[model samples]
Target: MDVIERFCNIYIDICQISPDDLESIYAKDVVFVDPITTHRGIDAVKHYFSNLLTQAESCKFDIADVFHCDGNNTARTQVTHIVNWTMHLTLKGNNKHITLDGTTQLNVVDDRVAYHKDYYDLGEMVYEHVPILGFVIKKIKGKLAS
Candidate 1:
């Protein structure tokens, strides 16, 4: 399967993803970034995911769309893939689930992801889930929308 296909399969059930699974889709020198932080190298990425998965009661990704930019044969380095997805996450000790929409850009080299960046609303994914913070964030959003 192609890199994007492999990525989708691995992320669809993030809670079950193992270090070996991450290795399959990412290069040894992979750089991964998300709303929270950036991790350089495959080992760092694996460590990040290990902690994240441990804190998550359940996590799932639903792919909404995928756009591929294939650079001309002359510039193999221009190839990039963008994937839009929605994530459903339930943190440990919290029965409530958070659904957040996000997009990921993947730079594939040699059929493995070398650079991965994710864009998502931190307020929706994290801040809004906090007890006092959720109320304040919602109030601020409501005020801003008016």
Candidate 2:
């Protein structure tokens, strides 16, 4: 199969597995970096995912788009994912279904993912869930970034 197909299947597999099943898809030498933390190898990746899933339930990913670039024995994919579900970063409070947009960049080597980078605004996820902090955070962030 082609690299893109392989990568898509990997993502589908991730969706199917429980968060505990991270080791299955991640290579032993995999490098996964995201906005908050950087992980090297499958073990660290597994640990990172463990912390993530602890706060969420019925987690689902909607793949909005996938951009593919192929080279000699290598492929990169830029993926847009829409996440909707419930999460508890603290206090285990109830939250409505939220839609979050994020991107993942994958480096494919020999049909396996060798390196992956995920990009997203964490404040959009965290502060937006609060009542008044949501608006204040957005405004402050906008003003600062500008």
Candidate 3:
């Protein structure tokens, strides 16, 4: 499979992801960025995922679509891909399941991801799940929408 497909498959079920798996798809100098933070290098990315997975009872990604522009497919000299997906997560000690829609941009070099950036709403993924904070945020959103 191509790098984009391989990358999507790896994230399908992150609960079982290993450092080796990450190494296979990511370059040693990979730069990973998400809503929470940014990590540089394969080791840092692995460490970030390790900590994130430990707090989750389960995590899964359902890829909705993928778009890419590569030399073979297009005239573009750069290789970049975008993936849209929905993430389902259940945190440890919390029975409540959270679902969030997100998109990721990936830059590939030598069949390995060199850069990755994820886009998602922090409020929808986190703040909306809190107790009092959730209620207040919802109220504010309702007021803004009206």
- All candidates: CA RMSD (Å): 2.1, 5.4, 3.0
lDDT of 1 by residue, 80-114 (tens): 98999999988898677889999998888888998
- Candidate 2 regions with alpha-carbon error over 4 angstroms: 1-16, 72-93, 141-146
* Candidate closest to the true structure, highest lDDT: 1
Off by over 4 Å in 1: 72-79
Off by over 4 Å in 3: 70-79
Which run of 10 residues does model 1 get worst, by summed lDDT?
A: 70-79
Q: Worst 10-residue stretch by lDDT in candidate 2?
A: 82-91
Indicate whether candidate 1 or candidate 3 has the larger lDDT.
1
Question: Could you tell me how far off, in angstroms, the CA of residue 4 lies in candidate 1 after the best superposition?
Answer: 0.8
| TM-score, model 2 to reference | 0.67
Counting clashing residue pairs in each candidate, in order, gives 0, 0, 0
